[model samples]
Target: MTDLNTLLQSPIRWMSQATDPDMRHFLRDLQANILKGHGRHFTGNIFVSFEGMGAQAVARLLRDLSGYVTSALQQLCTARSSAGPGFDGGPVRCLLLGAGAYRALGNLATMPGDAAFQAGMRARQVALADPPAEEWGEGAWRPGNPAPDAMILLANSSFEAVTRDLEAAEGWLNGSGARVLGVERGRAQFRTFRPGGPAEGVEHFGYVDGRSQPLFLAEDLKREAAAYAEEPAPAGADTGFDPAFPPSQFILADPNARTELGAGSYFVFRKLEQRVRAFKRREEALAEALGLTGTKAARAGAMAVGRFEDGTPVVLSDNATEAAPPNNFSYANDPEGMRCPFQAHIRKTNPRGESTPKLPPEAPAERSHIMARRGIPFGDGVRDFEADAGQEPEGEVGLLFMAYMASIEGQFEFTQQVWANNPRFLRGLAPGEVPTGIDPVIGQGGDEAARTQLWPAGEGKPMVPFSFADFVRMQGGEYFFAPSRSFLREVGL
Candidate 1:
């Protein structure tokens, strides 16, 4: 196994743009240089559970697992070394332990700092903070299920690489410490509505997914600024960012941290099953009701998703062909939600300027309530939503939703509960305006009848209403902590 402490303490000669241009020029003159790895696309996921395992056995498992940790530095080097067209940066792996697993070790008393990990993923506090019962489907989530003991994440440039890693992991874990209770493999699929239409890469809904993500930075000052930037600036514009901060939010400091545990991140794992057929039929029905047809019928879907199937934000331009950066648009200009309905999936989750009015005047700059989402699709690639609209789904398929954060309650949970699931979110509406509905895509409606969503046709048009059947069903999930390299070693030792 890799020496966790030594790995953590090793000098990482990372290079980047210098804060002082003069100092950078001096370094260039002296032939000094530095480089760092950008992030990698781990397109595969495998979640494992170790149940009924003893403390000693769990420790041994972690020791073995340490051998699989892939550092960011390695990723950079791999990318640099690639020479051929098919050459790749190789796979990266991560190991995370769930709250139940930690409690089973009987070490919460020794490591009181891991209170959040001990709380488990489905704890009442976590559930309440992330979408209440009224927002979830009937008995879909929060069914008093036991959480997983651990999760194994493997990311590679290709599916074959991931499969090979999965096989190796299964070999490594065979009776190593904990017996495997379950294994969920995550894979990515691509398809387009037309030949060469809207890059083949799309979620089951036929819209480009995972387009908007928070920036990842390493500095405290940058993170502080980003946390404030989640809400719009005073002039109702993006708080123009300083070049100092990386355009990412992964830099948030984790509170109640134990240094010995190394730099760790909290993870929220969910197995979501998408009802593609149901969603398509509903969209078609809604489009027909709204008198939307042909290319314009696409608007009905865009109103719900806040973007067309081609990833163009309707708030920015009506034509999906007008390719633009999807994340560049904000909600400030469309306060009345004429361009983007307040209930649109993108609008509800990250309201941007819309969040400012909801903040208490005395509160700290409203933190963006950000989470670094890293999830991939799972199940067989099914694109029958268009052809098999009225029929039952051919097979199971959907997103294996996963997110990394410093605080489950603050980031991931808040986005889900306070934003996505909140019907009354994006405050400061006129007295007579109706309250915004739940996110049409992922928002759970307690009962079938309550699943209504609002879809605006265009400016000066009445908000069109469409009821949704639970299209995305939550199967199971858990909360886990991915400890730093050193922390894993300490636990094993």
Candidate 2:
């Protein structure tokens, strides 16, 4: 068996040695897009369902599909050298199988024992506060509709590459007995800081995103630390924010795979539609309500988002114009939600070591819940920040939120139900204060009274109430397991 601890500590060095046959086998069996994100500019997600297919037929399908599945070792090798295969030297290809797919292959008994995965995402509709089946668009999770048996995730450096690969996969599936249920495409979007300057990653709401991710590999942790050291440090910034995590946080043993070293991760896929115009309008209206004018008016949105559009954390610096926003800050200094409000989208999603008071400064409880999010925006047109009232897309454009976790219920679902959707969260931290309120960005069902606290007058002043609205709506989603490459290759036999 591979020394998982040692391997995770220094993946590059471990792979360089290439002496440990067990470690090599482990990585070769494990699928890609779990340990590290693909970081591709364009992505194509193809959901396939098998109808009335027998175990023999499903096994045959898996055997054929295995040819396209990229292993973790392949991805790491490509990352190390640009002369590898696929477009732009590397195109990520992954296969995720749902509960129904496992059952169709007659392997349900030995699949990962996740109750949530077994029950499917549709079963958790009430708990997640997701819209009913009817509200979900076609090809999404709905009652009576065949649940997606398998999903083929293809990503590459360019839109043309992704489209070409997607078409090839679809053409093959047409005769493979599996039916292509739905297809979703994602492309990276960026916002230009200056007219001629390079663009930075931003979601539909114009907020810098994908920061504060948990680093699983030692090399990544070291790289992040080095990058942080090179940046200009702001005074009072907490340098103790450690992003390193153990390999067990994301990987689990594949019960039915051919190799003992086989490993996989639980994948959560959700299509979220952003009402950009409404959200932007609300931000401006909230600024007016808080009596904030001049440059400070931007804080209205920052109060709800926990960061300004430039990715500057409200806790670290109130000035959104501050260059190179640092992601190294924690909530240790602003425990009372005086700076970054407890209900802020970032705060709600990742508490950053402030969820529980009794837990030590490390806050392992909060950190344990962090998952590897590999999402991409799936829409067109640059957001018109100065557009008219009716302009900007209210729907048909949003995020293809994808994440990998060891436990669906513990990490992804817990963060949503217990933190984001729960208005009572962080209430224990501040006794006798107003409800922390739902996360304004992604919080689902809540009453009109659900409002976030904002202190425009600074600390010691009463908070202004900004009623929360559903700016991001759930279009559809499902849960699947990114199976081990060994499992996919040997399942038929």
Candidate 3:
């Protein structure tokens, strides 16, 4: 088993990983914003294709990247020395290789067993039922941008540090003459930041984001237990389920039992463009239709998102801020989907204590479904839906969604396919009842009719049949592997 110290510093292990040198290597985003309590200060993603690069050139480039890549120990020491007391911010960067990129360099027998990872992003669009060209922006979906072979990420606490790190990476990639690696750049490149300029925790949709994430690592679980002890629980909230996921749950074993890369995780990247104006407009309409006005109108949005904008889960709070958000809860008590709709975004994606009929009874529990979501919101601040009512906005915007998992097919893809996109998810039918709707926020129901959810109307009210306009569009994305430090030093180098 890989030592917890050797793992990455993802959201699941943020508490414990920060102190351990090996684990810190994985905490790519910690240096970005202090107020948000976690995540990168800013993240820059540069996608590249290796169309004509030969094996020798590709190998050389990987070696150069091995040298350029920042280690977590370096980040920790650098942060301590430069940031003064209590600040752990530093210019941190990571490099990942897509399957296309790996094939471009030279096919590897060490690649993961997951078919989804072996097949490129274009293949995934069809398998995942993502929207086709007509539904997506120009050059956004499949076949528009060529599948990228590699992605470089630069993260920092301040905009200047972010710029500095990106410049360094850009300079390395664009090295002149002998240093060049026969690189061919791709179109999908963007940086991420907190919406509304450096103020942390708010997503483009005005929701306090990143709540209810899973806890891993000993320290993370300990901290949560401490917080839960101090805080008042929502009536009947289950706080006893252990959040500590053993390494076997999320880490990949060395496929060859001798390779460094085997210790790494597969990364799933998707650029989801949120239709803010359209979503907000729908919320207003739904609110009015539900006889809710002003603040109550927000409940309509909450019903769709399964959480109030404040990051509180609907199952726990009537309003977004009724009680502070709680991390632990299960669907055992709310089987009928009364408090939280069966197809609500969070419920569909994680389904705590809820049995999924499509999945086997012996299948891993909800803990296995957890993702180390390192995603950051990109694009301009929240769109002025009211002001820009009819006209289109200037540039692209939404989440630069990225998740690190041992199995793309098992965790991230499973959540998307079996849970989120399936309208029949969490089924418990009574004669002639309508099926649950797809996840309104991220679920890509190809047809308009497939994009509907049965909204749980408050106590005694009849369940409202709510239809959803596809609000999130899949821009381009590819799967990549962030190799371990050992892998870089040995095979990648």
Candidate 4:
């Protein structure tokens, strides 16, 4: 029979195929943060979509995941159905996993070689012991579990089956009360990776999504373990790490050096709302300031966001020049806030050039606190909303921003508090250039519209970029330590 090692090695061996430079640091940092503590008390969270199949199949899949529950994990959260009875026009047929459920899933990672999985793996990736779904095959997956509190980005597959298959997964995520979590779409998809910048948002601007992802850490961990198991780490084991803090290490319940229930990653979840129409209205109105009339204004709007409302980045220049691809430019290159404006939404959140000196352009991957973004678009898409619906978003569209960081202060917090909200962005300003402004996107705001402070707005930005007093509001969230696969089996539920 194909042993657990071989099955596990499949994805791990091919790890390099799933990652890029930007993503490695993100996951490593995730490793550090999760290892910092057991994260006993669950807190942060965010859920994602999965491609769907059919009902009888999906409904059966959902039942298998929720078959059992534990006590410790249950106190944290509960999982169930989104739609009322079954998966008809159900709330998209989902599986809401709770902290308790996640903990149970983690244990599956350390599945023993001689365990039932031995026969199971030999049978197929997906195993259906009973009439219901059972194998961890292309159709069936693992325990729908959670990994260590570190950044593994490990998954059985990447393609999510929301309309059909994910009904089981949705149960675990939405079911949990804690936060600090998200699911990624991958081949042999499993929840072994760390999600950042809205924790793997579904769509960037207007793409089908599951497209843009990190550049760091490999995708398959089984392959990595097998490859590096024999080879020694380079001379400076901590080669690319920081001198002041170095990298973080985790201890698990293993023969090499066992520790019960120790060393796991975390899952952080956040439900962020996006004001599509409001954002558009503001952008459209602001375009007038540039004096770009009609077609010109349309271009101006696209440029302001570095992309068209359709999620097409302006940097692409219509695939003409690669000089500036979307999500890859410096706002200061055009200090007038002309090309990619000081108040552009993406620019504000990521603030590429705003913190130049602080960032090592030579090694964009060097920064310790920096993280990768995995935001998914939530709610309804852009649509005309009635004026009265401001309290309740018009179309119900929003971006779930999730980031995995070694240090929340530097990675997550800094990005949100300073870069995204801070006004006097990039140190000194050009003589004639106006002060930096608040990020038009996630930047906060208040009751009155005029009170809104953006570039070329009320009080020319200075100390605070935008004067959004009560704009983006937090709906629900939670944080939990995502343990490694081993920790789940030996010391956990």
Candidate 5:
């Protein structure tokens, strides 16, 4: 027995030691230094909480946590680091806070000073004043807990500096009564894809991924009662608090939070091997069997997934050209799935409206899940290998798939179990069927239909609309939680 209870309490214990108003200043200096990082190999992430700590306290910790993070990052930039010839691809960017960082505000009752308490209480006001969209790329923001003490971010760093910073942070946090949590060297997978080639890495059937992320202020987020009541409820929800633990699908970190919620993000890294030859052979063979030619069959295949192979959405611009504005299109323009089959890979993964198990906007059942995709393609290193060649099982080559989410069961797991890995997703079809469970880019599930997502979607159609012979493969992975900066300062040494 691993004594899961004790394991769970470890991080909390480390955090209890660093509880002081002065510790806040130490964190501020740390933060300032981190914000100034310009290293190439070194990446940074931040998490600042007010949980057991307070606003003046959090303000204290936030001011310097960045410094330690930056120093840790610099230590990771050495020449011996991964990113070597065979290094796996994960997020290279360090995530910072949005409004979600407020979760660290801690238990309102446990904090001190009535005046400071009031300011700390106003985090929601601060949150409403600013949101993640205002910070991350376009509408992109960081989210999720993927490992403790932000260990995963040190994937390719030197141990000496990591040790130095580790000791310093440990010293401060140990003084508090808080505990530190860690999942050192947690591994993630990355899957990559080649145009008209084999599937490998993440996001196999290529439809602009990381787009189906949860909309915090969407009409649904506001309709719920519990969602609004728990902790830092989203803007639409009335939780008074803000969602900070998982931060966003993008990376965001905090200073002293143990259960930082949405305050920080993780760098997911996975190696997805694509079967290039397999996909091409399957596509070409399917095209010929259907008595279709270049453009016609290609169009139909594109229709199966809401987008073209070049990362363009077909629903908005059914054309196969890369010029499609898939990233900025409105769902109102085309919601019926006429151009893109309702079972397309992209559609299945992010079913904006076509969900079969419909629930009210306020329903708590299906709202917990929703993640941001921050993955990239990694394979064939240079040459765009033939998709058909990849199918032959020559080994290697594919997208390095990586995703970040607040709750694995809610976001990543749901996407895997109900959408990408489940065939009957849209309505009622074989598991892993096209459109519903089709994972075109870097496949991870093992069900038969998932192996050939196109099979079922094409079965009943009178004209046999689309077919996918290719398969996406999952290499390996695990789950983790990234803690808040305060948690780290108190316990992660």
Candidate 6:
């Protein structure tokens, strides 16, 4: 038997011909969008409910759909010829089964032992600080709302392609003993600041997204190392950030699979609506309150976001630069939250090296909480940094936040509850320090004081006080398990 942990420690080179059978089988059986994101420009999520369907009938439908599901190996092969770092396969499909689906299938006992997944997202509302289910958007998770049993993800390079694929899928699903509840569509937006440079991914809020990510494959690590080595290091640049992560961070055993190599990942999906106009207006107000004006006023938003709209980390540089942003740094150098405020969005969620008891960057306890984020912007809104005063979007625009993790309680929930929404996080780093405050961008359900941030002034000066308003609202979400290809194929048997 292959020691899965040992095999995963060494990154699997998918393209290598001499790769071991164990690694190759694992990749072939694992579903796509876990090890790497399905970076297609267009995506559609089809929520399905099998409330009235017979178990046998639903099983048949799933068994048939399994054949069309894409695997990690297949995605990599299709994207090998692409010039960029995304999958090129048109109309790629990934099917995720919710805990309710397992119950409907009469296999709830065999589902992965995750309490949060079993309890469902709506049941944990108070823990996550999410609004009541009734307040969420239409088709959101709520009791007596015909909970979603399955979600079919369709992705392609164009909106037309994704639409056509979704239509076809819905047509077949309608007659396959399943009912389609609702559909969520997403598209990738990019901004090209330079005339000829490649466009970088940006959210509706005009900030670059998906820059810092954990690398699982050996080839990806090598590629990143080569790129970092080729780029000349800036003055005082901390290149100590290690992006490598073991497969154990995401992969978990499939309890009901037919083979030992079969594995899957826990998936978390949330619809976050961004209040762009309010957030931008608040940024300007904050700048004015701090007595900053002109070009220096941009620091207000940068401090709140932990990075400028151009992707430059505010901790590293006070001003956004035209050059490519660097992610190879930690908070070890700036222990006093002087460079990047403790309440900054990125810093609050990912402390990098900062911790309550001051853990190192490579500590297993801290690193275990990291998950693979694969989110993309959903609504049509502003995608530029310098939009006019009235140009920012106020509603129906934000992130279709999606991520994969080994444990929902340990990773996604821990980051959201223990870090982002907590005001006293990182308090033990210094003595007699005030509450660090909740994350300004995504923190929710906090009091006015909890939402207040302590903005640093110059050295030896008292910190300025600024309270942030809620700018991001959670519309709806669910927990799912992306089963291994082998398990999906064999589940209905």
Q: Which candidate is the best by lDDT?
A: 6
Model 2: pairs clashing at backbone N, Cα or C within 3 Å: none
Model 1, 1-493: lDDT tens digits are 2222332232222233235443232222110001121233334444445566777777777766766676444544465578467677677777777766666666621332435556765565445333443443322243332456777777777667777887888777775755454566666656454454454456667777765555433333354455555733324444332222122233222222234223456777777788777787778888887788887887777888888887777776665754333344566566677776777888877665557766779753435466667777777544544564467463377787887666676777677777776677663255875667667888764443335656666557786777754677776666777655544555645
Q: Model 5 over residues 327-351: C-alpha lDDT tens digits?
A: 4333444444445655566666666
Per-prediction TM-score to the true structure, in the order listed:
0.77, 0.92, 0.81, 0.47, 0.49, 0.94
Q: For candidate 5, which ten residues in a row score worst on lDDT?
A: 133-142
Q: Each candidate's lDDT (Cα)?
A: 0.59, 0.80, 0.62, 0.34, 0.38, 0.82
| lDDT per residue as tens, model 4, 159-273 | 3323233444445534433223343332110111122312221232222232222222222223334544454332312221111222221111222112322233223434455
Candidate 1 segments whose C-alpha is farther than 4 A from its true place: 1-50, 108-117, 125-146, 191-200, 217-261, 322-326, 362-367, 382-395, 427-430, 447-450, 458-461
- Root-mean-square deviation per candidate: 7.8, 3.0, 5.7, 17.0, 16.1, 2.5
Candidate rank order under lDDT: 6, 2, 3, 1, 5, 4
**Cα deviation of 218 in candidate 5 (Å)?**
16
- Over the stretch 369-429, how does candidate 6's per-residue lDDT look in tens digits? 9889988889754355565556788988889999999999999999999889999886633
Off by over 4 Å in 3: 1-38, 75-88, 107-109, 133-145, 175-200, 238-242, 254-262, 356-359, 381-395, 428-433
Best by TM-score: 6
Q: What value does the lDDT take at residue 22 in candidate 6?
A: 74
Question: In model 5, which runs have C-alpha deviations exceeding 4 angstroms?
Answer: 1-151, 154-262, 265-270, 322-324, 330-338, 360-362, 365-368, 385-394, 429-470
Consecutive 10-residue window with the lowest summed lDDT within model 3: 180-189
Q: Tell me the tens digit of each residue's lDDT in model 2 across 188-276.
A: 87777555555788888888878888777666777898988876655565544677777777877777778767788999999998988
Model 5: lDDT to the true structure? 0.38
Q: Across residues 232-346, which tens digit of lDDT does each residue of candidate 3 receive?
A: 6556755434555654445554342233223556778787777776777888877776777876777888777777766666776667554456656665557688877777777
